[model samples]
Target: MKIIGIVDTTFARFDMGSAAVDEIKQYVSARIIRITVPGIKDLPVASKKLIEEQGCEIVMALGMPGAAEKDKMCAHEASTGIIQAQLMTNTHIIEVFVHEDEGKDEKELAFLMENRAREHARNVVDLLFKPEKLVKQAGTGQRQGFEDVGSLRG
Candidate 1:
């Protein structure tokens, strides 16, 4: 059986990680292993260990960077490390980040984070089991925080 690793940080809103896992479980039958760290910076190493030691085929990393300049910088560093780990492990690490500044208020931020996490979890399932859905959507301008453009209908 295939396994998926879910790595999340405590600094983020608590619901995001659980939302992702819930969505994944609804879609696929793969075994999921979850690890929570203190901050986004720890996602990479934990993900690598999951892949190398725990035999995960892919990892889903969820984080919410605060709306400060330093926080963004730290998120960037964590993303870079995640990329390196992906390269080292030769596996996909889906990084789902919801910046606190993206929303107008606390409630909006929470909603956005939850939706994004669930969406990315669906992405993980598609990556593993149904690649054609992702492939068919490519270049359709369907991205995070935006409505699907769908080939620029005239």
Candidate 2:
């Protein structure tokens, strides 16, 4: 049986975490253990504990960084920490962050966050069960909202 750990932050919009978890459940049959922290900066240690103590195979981290310089800096630091945790545990952590500036309005931001969370949840499933799906995307530069012009030369 596979176990997936989900780490989310209260600073993010509420729906993002739920969306990711829902999407993950739709594709894989795994026991999901969720941990909600107060902010993005708290994810790394929680993620490490999930992997080392909770026996999770993979982790999905969800957070939203506000449109402020400080927020961006904090997000960067958190991301680096998560990478270190992944290396230490030899496990995969899917970090999904939606910056508030990515959208023009609150509605758009919420929509984007939800979509991004779901998309990354699918990524988590692919990484665990169907890695080939992701390998095929290498160097494609294909993002969620953009068209894929893989190796196309004008």
Candidate 3:
């Protein structure tokens, strides 16, 4: 089974004959073909054609150009700081005007806020595992979904 997945051309140059490419050649079999696209915009179209021509049954893709990369930028500090910021802002605005942990309930609320942010980060990672299904269109000859994070955020 030959499988094709896309990668960012800016981040890595893909070679079908290279050892790394050979390793993921296929999700199931020994034969695999990895094609590097100039950008994320071209992955789906390329995969669709490859699926038809190469008889690719499953297309498992990976591109960490962004999503997870966000976490790796000062992982330790951001994890604590971002959540703390969210807690302080949301607590006063939404929950109640409690900035510091004076009571047991306030401390628990702060803890919950921190956990929620951490969970949000985990969700970000979970979604990053996919092409980010944002908008979907269905027609007689074409079906597509756009997952570009930049476009999604905008």
Candidate 4:
């Protein structure tokens, strides 16, 4: 059986990790491990630990950056760290970040959080079990939280 890690941040108001778990369970049978950290910056190490120590094949790093300049900067740094961890581990860490400012209201924000998490969770399943499914959709402008813009090639 495969192991999928969900490393989320407590700073996020929505339970994106749960959304992801629910989505993944719909497709395949894999051991899902969940880890909670304090903030976005902590996602890299936590996800890395999940991969290296906990034997996770793929990880979802979920975070919600506040609607502020500093928060955006921190998210950027955390993203960089996530990328580095992925390179070091030679594994995929799907960064699921929903900026607080992306939505105009709480309802919209929650919707985006859930949608993005669920969509990425499906992507994880594809990466683990069915890469060709994703390849078939390449350049299709498949947005997670919002409406897909569709492929440019008509």
The Cα local distance difference test for each model comes to 0.89, 0.87, 0.32, 0.97
Clashes of each: 0, 0, 1, 0
Estimate the lDDT of model 3: 0.32
**lDDT string, candidate 2, 53-98, tens digits:** 9999999988988889999999999999999999999999989888
The total of clashing pairs for model 2 equals 0
Clashing pairs in 2: none
Tens-digit lDDT string for candidate 4 (6-111):
9998999999999999999999999999989999999999999999999999999999999999999999999999999999999999999999999999999999
Query: lDDT winner among the candidates?
Result: 4
- Pitting candidate 3 against candidate 4, the one with the higher lDDT is 4
Ranking by TM-score: 4, 1, 2, 3
RMSD in order of candidates:
1.4, 1.7, 18.8, 0.5
lDDT for each residue of candidate 3 in 1-154, tens digit (9 for 90 to 100)? 3233322233322221132233333222334445655533344444454445665433322222222544344233333432443343331100111122222564454443343323322222233333243223112222111122333223
Residue-pair clashes, model 4: 0
Q: Which residue pairs in candidate 4 have backbone atoms (N, alpha carbon, C) closer than 3 angstroms, thus clashing?
A: none
Relative to the true structure, candidate 1 reaches a TM of 0.94
Q: Estimated TM-score per prediction? A: 0.94, 0.92, 0.30, 0.99
What candidate 4 gets wrong by more than 4 Å, as runs, is none
Overall local distance difference test of candidate 2 = 0.87
